[model samples]
Target: METKILPRILIGAPGSGSGKTTVVCGILQALINKGLNIVSFKCGPDYIDPMFHKEALGLESRNLDLFFNDKETINYLLAKNSKEADLAVIEGVMGYYDGLAGKSYEASSYDLARSTKTPSVLIIDCKGKSVSILAEIKGFMELESDSNIKAVILNRISPMIFEEIKKLIEETLPIEVLGFMPMIKECSLESRHLGLVTAQEVGNLETILDTLAKQVSESIDLDKLIRIAKTASKIEFIKPTIACGERVRIGVAKDKAFCFYYQDNLDLLSEFGAEICYFSPLEDKKLPENLQGLYFGGGYPELYLKELEKNDSMKQNIKDALSAGTPCMAECGGFMYLHEVVKDKLGHAYKMVGTIEGESFYADKLVRFGYIDMEAEKTNLLCEEGMHLKGHEFHYWDSTNSGDCFHAQKPLRKMNWKCVIGNENLYAGYPHVHFYSNIKSAERFVDICRKRKTKI
Candidate 1:
């Protein structure tokens, strides 16, 4: 199959808290409103911002992490998604320079930009610094000489400061000043201890997004921005390698509590003839009847512990499904939801599905973080016994006890800690695995689900 490449734009910041999220969200909404099918991508292991992007653009926003998958796969995913859209906009992680230690260049935004050959637009917070902003842009440009920095968007600036900073940046750097937006006095996105609140949690996210789009459209030079994005060099596309399979229906938990998912994962499942049905664990009375498989992605299950505890019938339903030999694959927050108990930061405990015999407690410090390379020590639905998968772990909770039913194994750590566990027909882990890293994991998972469905 021939690949199709689209005009692309990469939005990044100097570091965290530089208003990248707000700016990116606004950009996504504005472009989407222009009747362009805008496919979005988030740079690192983030679930929340992608949700907002999806909400803004009405498209499935995918993650592009160099740590989890090879460059070939990343290129394939970018090309695959680009086919369905007029343009693609990727939001970068932490600073453009921040990435894993040993694999710094691999996981950084610069890597993604280079691999995809996408032009980048730096969103610099011009709150206090005026003249120094040029130096920051120069440093970023020089840090990666091959990087195609098309433009700079000055954020959090007053009118006086915006003009001063804009003039200095254009005079000092060899890049165009795309636009600027003043720091607005509006109710911003809610955040938790980790980061911004998940899009599922925001009640009026549509209104918030509309407000954001209007703000960007009113503030930024939309025409110049589009032209800059169009100037990105187009690269040859690569089609995803889809394995042959019979059509299977999979029930995916997708609500405020369990919203972490990759667009590519879903696309892979679709490519393999699996029909995905999304159900909310928070609102759904029970799982879809006679579903072939259950996929519970990661989210802020800790925040809605009380509500989850109240849904005793739903908890029991999931426990019964697992006990009946239904294959299940769960990531960090989803893994916690299957445990016996999940305690919040306040030490209040809530009853979970009890499929996995463990109690998860919120710790003051981060337990596991960063990329991991895992070798499956035992057979499970997600991977064959000895198959290796690259993934990452980012969480604050620690499992103090795993009751007699479950066991953790094959611990791997580079910068963060990771472990896998199994109980009943379910395989759970702290490391958030993206199926793009190993398509075999998805195929194996669906195969187990098919077998379980036949038995039923």
Candidate 2:
């Protein structure tokens, strides 16, 4: 097979608040306006960054998580999604060098750059210092044994200062100074417990993107960026085989409240002969008629407590459907919704479907966050007993009855706990799973749904 020539560049930062998202969104909007097909990607297990990409470019952004996904999967996704696009831009997760922990670069943005053989542009926040910034950039470049970093983008720096710094940086380091981006206070996105507030909450998204596009077009050099993206080496990938089976109708809960799902997860379901029927738990009166199973993904359900609670008919309908032997899978916010009550950040309790026992409380701090390996404590719709699944856990809430159906253990922290309620028909909990972690997980779910369809 001929190798695909992928023109890709990763936008990364020194640390978290280095204006990587702003710069990435700006560049995407600017490129799209120039009539270039742009496919975006996020480097980690982030759902919100991709949402922002969709809002900016109207193209569905995918993920390239090095933590759970292998090099082959990464190349396949990069090539598959970039087929017709002019260029693909992947925004980094954390710092360029930071990874799973302080020690290993297992799942860092740099790892994604190396794994995909893509070049990275490090964004530096030159807010309060000048010469000090150069030291930082030099450190980032030299610290990493293998240099995937090719360029530097200065953020929150004046044009005059950028020119001076650019000269100093170019003369000293063997990297290009892409451009400088001014701080746009008006275009700042809101932040919550789980990173930025989703695109759903941003009312003036288009307006913001337009502003960013205009600013980026004038400030940054798009032609240079395209050239940098094109510098990526040729890569080869073998497409993985999709599962084939009996067709089944799966009701997927999609909306502002349940929007945190991996794009691959849904793609795998469809490949397995699932006719996805998307219904809004926020707006829909009831579930889709005659569903073999239901999927409730993670999101900010607690934020819309009043609206979710007001829809009594839909809540009871879901509870009733579960009781009627319909297979159900819920995670985090979705899991919270299945409890007797869910508390808002303000500590106000709202009644929810009581399929699962106990009240889900919104704790101020993160509850068992980071990646983990989940072993099925017993047989479930997704996995068999003793089946191992790798996924991440990110939430600021906890349930009294998290269940003991699965045993979840985090590698670095050496932490372990019981989670999920699963059987041949149902699986629900706080851990947001990536279907690729265990392909059989999605396979089993679809198989269970197929059996449900047979009963009907």
Candidate 3:
């Protein structure tokens, strides 16, 4: 097996609000300021952290999710994205050990670290406590035999207190204290219903990132951080071979209204010889010309119903394109857009492209959330009979046309439910799929596009 030696560290927290993102943003910008190439990765399914990383370093961040992919795929993606980079900083999910139902380590940051053989630096929030912080850090360090936690970053601590805490921790425990942040309110990022607001929404993100870099560089020890990252073992895995079809053009909806897409999924589509032309459903008048297929991933379509409804040309064009036999894949919010109408909060109904014969009503609460292994109940646009694909669904809306072409089942259990709403040319559902889970799923879509290239 071939191996690649990449210096990396998984930045994790005891839990959410441990200042992990702030510290990560600081470290990323500091490294970038030193003229180093940094590849940023988010451990779980959350897309918001990666947005901050990209905003800080001007580089596209990627995600490594264990729920949607196996360890081999994780290593392949990590190595593929971190190639030739000076350092790889992986920002972890909620807590160090939180995953699935908060009882398993299936998709936790600890799982990511152990699977990829990368060391971790645990971030501890040291507010309103002193010696108890040591207990917190020590407990986390010794929780699992292979904790992968090599160092600690104390948040909301002064230099003098940090020195005392560092002295006590290093003396009593085998862990190293890397740095401490003195709780700067200006360094914080705001959040919303989904999570942190997308990086693009923060108008002064560049300025904020520069300030964070300065603060982190002043507080953290970059030399020790780099040394720890360099200690990561060489990763051994075979990168999956992607089968490419004849070149085909596909339209992808990407905008404020529809932006939840994995970087790997898009890259895999390109690797399979699909020219992905990105357009906006909220602003664009029509789909890209001469397209063989279309992809509309999960996003906040309900938030911009008025804008989407006002764009009559766009809605009619999309409906016409699908009717013309162009293969389409819509997930979550995208699925909502294909309905006759989408009723948002406050009981306002907005007209949508009536591809599916139903309406999507927002239900204030998550209809069905979490990981699932999808088995095609019947052959459709992206899969054949009994084809299994790993994905997850997290949406607040329900459609009257959740197609019965597939049955999505829990990974560690026997529970399953019929989903998706389409035939051989379309597959619309609430679940967001990661293409890396099954290469054939993407290849099949590309093949369909290739076959329909001449007719369109």
- Which ten residues in a row are the worst by lDDT in model 3? 189-198
lDDT of 1 at 66: 84
- Candidates 1 and 3, the one with greater lDDT: 3
How well is each residue in 308-364 modelled by candidate 2, as lDDT tens digits?
999999999999999989999998889999999998777888999889988999789
The whole-model lDDT of each prediction reads: 0.77, 0.86, 0.86
TM-score against truth, every candidate: 0.90, 0.96, 0.96
lDDT per residue as tens, model 1, 1-456: 454547888898888888888788887888888888888898987776777766645776888888787777887777766666778889999888777763366688888898878889999888878777888899989877787777889988887667777777787778899788778646354243126465555676678778878988987887888787787776665565667577678888988788778777877777777789888889988998768888888888998898899888888888888887777878888989999999988998898999877699988887656666766666666766667777766789878642222222322322323366753356687667788888887777777767776776
- Give me candidate 2's TM-score against the actual structure: 0.96
lDDT digits (tens) for residues 1-456 of candidate 3: 668999999999999988788777878888999898889999887666676566546876999999888998899899898879988999999889987766798899999999999999998989888999989988998899999999998988877788888899999999899988888786676343126256777677778778888888888898899999999999888977776768999999998888888888888989999999999998889888889999998878888899999999999999988988999999888999999999988778889998988899978898877888898888998899888888888888898778898888876666678899867888899988888888888998888888889665
- Give me candidate 3's TM-score against the actual structure: 0.96
Candidate 1 global Cα RMSD: 3.2
Question: After superposition, which runs of candidate 2 have C-alpha atoms over 4 Å from their true positions?
Answer: 190-196
> What TM-score does candidate 1 get on C-alpha atoms?
0.90
Model 2 steric clash pairs = none
